[model samples]
Target: MKLSLNSFVVVALFAQFASARDTQIPLEWDKKVTWTEKYGPQSDQPFSGLLSFSHLPYTRCLENEATKFDIAVLGMPFDTGVSYRPGARFGPFAIRSGSRRQRATNGYTMSWGNSPFNQGVKILDCGDVPISPFDNALAVDQIEVAYSTLLDRPSAEGMGERDITRLISKDGIEHPRIVTLGGDHTIVWPILRSLHKVYGPISVIHFDAHLDTWEPKTRYPGQTTDQSRVTHGTFFYLAKEEGLISNQSIHAGIRCKLEGLADIENDESVGFQLVTADDIDDLGIPEIVRRIRQRVGDTPVYLSLDIDVIDPGLAPATGTPEPGGWTTRELKRILRGLVGLNFVGADIVEVAPAYDSADITGIAAADFVHDFLSLFLAEKPPSVGPPAYREEL
Candidate 1:
């Protein structure tokens, strides 16, 4: 048989491939392992004695000998109080996972000029409350009790005594500031009730799409069950009724749908002035920051930031997402603007990782927590801000 030039080239290429295949290393079939990690898990993880945030593991507040610390990062793994979705019970895990890379040592970022890690404070990762997923009422009580126990604890003996926020406790003692990783927005009501015991009526800086102050009975008209009354949507109303929060609170990024215009009036009756998401365009970011500062000036304030406050397009892991919200950049800039406020404690909630993609929502939530720690320090940001960075460290 006569062969064409193309056939000759094909045979040559086939023979060359067979020769290359013969020289290649054979694939491993056995399952025996030889590779080993160079360092222990604690070297990179933030927590000690567990699989959680990169800090000291703690949840012994109920015990008589819980480790004492200045500031603690607590997790609320209860989402049963949510009105729209489930799975936020896993929010603490996701947020903590997002925060794994954070180390207090060399924790400086040029964006803020300082890092929460280097602030001369012992901020431990107090692990999540063992909230009962079966009962919302029990879960709510558990969170309140857990938070109060930690909130009332004494600050680290010598550290954070230099804090100048003028925030005083009922006992005239220095109390620890807790940055909470929340399961849902309903967690705030219990937190406020807890802080009320320590700081009396504290102010609020609520960042969310909805006016969570809705009077459930009035707004829903017929779903008047006791459980329905105190959901994520109506916890603020419950707080106002219980006098856990002050009228001095303000709500930024308000743009959620309401039952009617009466919802605005109800929110006002609950003592919140609205700063809609669109207000950033007309009022400007600095002005919005000014209003928040002016309203809560030196008062013991609690900041509750919902992950849904950022546009769903940017952070979609939230249970109740409303479009046309602030970008993560604008949100961070506003948070930085709030550097000097006398906030006692704060939470970033409604992070349902089941709906999230690319871990954007979790990263945003974790970074918010980082900012929360810095805000407690109350160090004035530089006039021009921290120097820009070349790349990630």
Candidate 2:
């Protein structure tokens, strides 16, 4: 208490040292520290391992001992069928790159109350189909063959099985579902062919700005049939001719101007009811869901989402973007409402990233795929073990 100035200085120095020694430092001072190798290997780098969809493991469907997966994502990089834009050939890459955003979390959706990646489903990116760039006919045939090859792969045993009451197919075989990242809407034709071979003519829930059911028209006036004219606009027409779709199919978010009134008649003739973009305000999301469920009740459905179905302000990097369409929020809500529908396959197409602004369209496309996967996983039976997120995280 009666210390001198020099004594006070010495006491303060000793107190400071004591405090510093008492504090527990985070680093191990006795251990050898190497600055260059402090973090070990960088496994999460973009260039490492397989660049498959959403950075998932890459597996081949045609391999000798292929890993059985519940869902397979195959990229169809063929875009010759586009009538307006050509760069949708790069859509699958853009979508996969943008999907890195979802990897930070557990890939969970609050809207669905579950993570698609955590529901005992084994998913793999099976890579892109080998497509012909020069010959459209040959390209179509190649896509059909590639899709069929993947569809024929056996599903993972006892993984992500649906409820017994929901298994309506008489064959007792639970085929693996596909989530195709698109080249264009034309890819749906070959997909329809493949799905038909497995589960006969399916009901479709088509979302687009255009009807995409146009008759094949010739460039010249004197032609009887345009054998070389299988554009994206005419795929559903061809599907109708081949009896690949049921009358219960429906089209939503359609707002494009048509060549004539016959286009609606033609689309209706091909077994599709129309719900234009303008109808969203009048009917609301719940009514729209009711309409869709009532139209394709208890049938196997193939969901096709064209990016142009979203407003160009939100998703401008599509092949044929129209002015009037749904916002991203509206689209997500509508997709979430389609929970119990028997969705066998789905695709999000027409994303041309060259025209995208700051990857807004790519991110939107990735979100759609995520939402589709959530819907698919949510429809499965209860998991036999703890959820993957609970155990892995």
Candidate 3:
């Protein structure tokens, strides 16, 4: 049979395939495999002991007597402080659920060159603060008490004074730093009070569309001088009045309509410098980072991120949606630039999942929390001079 080149090639390929198929691995080898023992249960099974933030072990504040943790993930589920929307109470749950996506990756950040989880720090989710839905004031008090309890050591014989500035490890137990999953912006006020007790007046790195430094107003439409007047819009005012924050504090990404000239004046009165969303255009992100580092130099800092700080197009699940704002990438860059700052506590707030589609806002909030953890766990830079306060004119 005179074979063309194509016919010869086809015959050769078939012969090779038949020969290869005849030498397949023995069936006994396949039967000897312990598939269930090697892989354990199904890969898709829901993770146990998972709380929001990583798949860190779950522990309650009251029950952590034996296990000492360096960082505690807490959820504040109260949202009575919001003026525009009511669903921020679900912020913590949504943020946690979104964080499950982060579990597969080995907590390595290229910028840090180390896994934050691999740091000497031990992290635990302390679960959510039990807050009252009906009483805002009571809920705030509950949050404050819960936070204080987590950060403070109980008075006991031979247990010396608690140091708020640094985590203390005594008698085989360690004090914890807190990362709050927020109910709303107002939750910061109570968390600040808790932090002030430990770190004294800390500087705040506030990312929000509104200043959140407005004077207190009625809680609702009909009420006057209500006890719950200190709302999400006005908690920073309360924080400043209570001496919880330092004058070096700064606000970024503010683009909401303010109450005429007085609003700016009022915010200045609270001692925060403004880095409006427009400023990102005028001054590049590096300059913005430089300004923030300059403002918060060497001070114990608390970061409060309102989800609305990002543009509504990217993060539409927040209570207040502002048109002109930051992109998630820009925000991430700014946050990464803030590594080595003295971050004692932080929160990602105003995430109302009801307003969200496809969990975009929730994922952003969770990732922000992750970035914060990385920065907090990273080594501190050498101390600069005492952070200077910017006074209102």
Error of 2 at 390 (Å): 26
**How do the predictions measure up, each by TM-score?**
0.84, 0.84, 0.80
Off by over 4 Å in 1: 1-42, 45-50, 54-61, 158-161, 164-167, 383-393
Model 1 TM-score, 2 decimals: 0.84
lDDT of 2 by residue, 136-187 (tens): 8898899898887777777874454553212644465677788999888999
Candidate numbers sorted by TM-score from highest down: 1, 2, 3
Q: How many backbone clashes does candidate 1 have?
A: 5
- Evaluate all candidate structures by whole-model CA lDDT and list the values in order: 0.80, 0.80, 0.77
Q: Please state the error at residue 151 of candidate 3 in Å.
A: 1.2
Per-candidate alpha-carbon RMSD to the true structure: 6.3, 7.7, 7.0
* Native-to-model Cα distance after best TM-score fit, residue 152 in candidate 1, in Å: 1.5
State the displacement of the C-alpha of residue 248, model 1, in Å, after optimal TM-score superposition. Answer: 0.7
Candidate 3: list runs displaced more than 4 Å.
1-38, 41-51, 153-164, 167-175, 217-223, 380-393
lDDT of 1 by residue, 43-77 (tens): 54344334455544445554644578878888898
lDDT of model 3 at position 43: 46
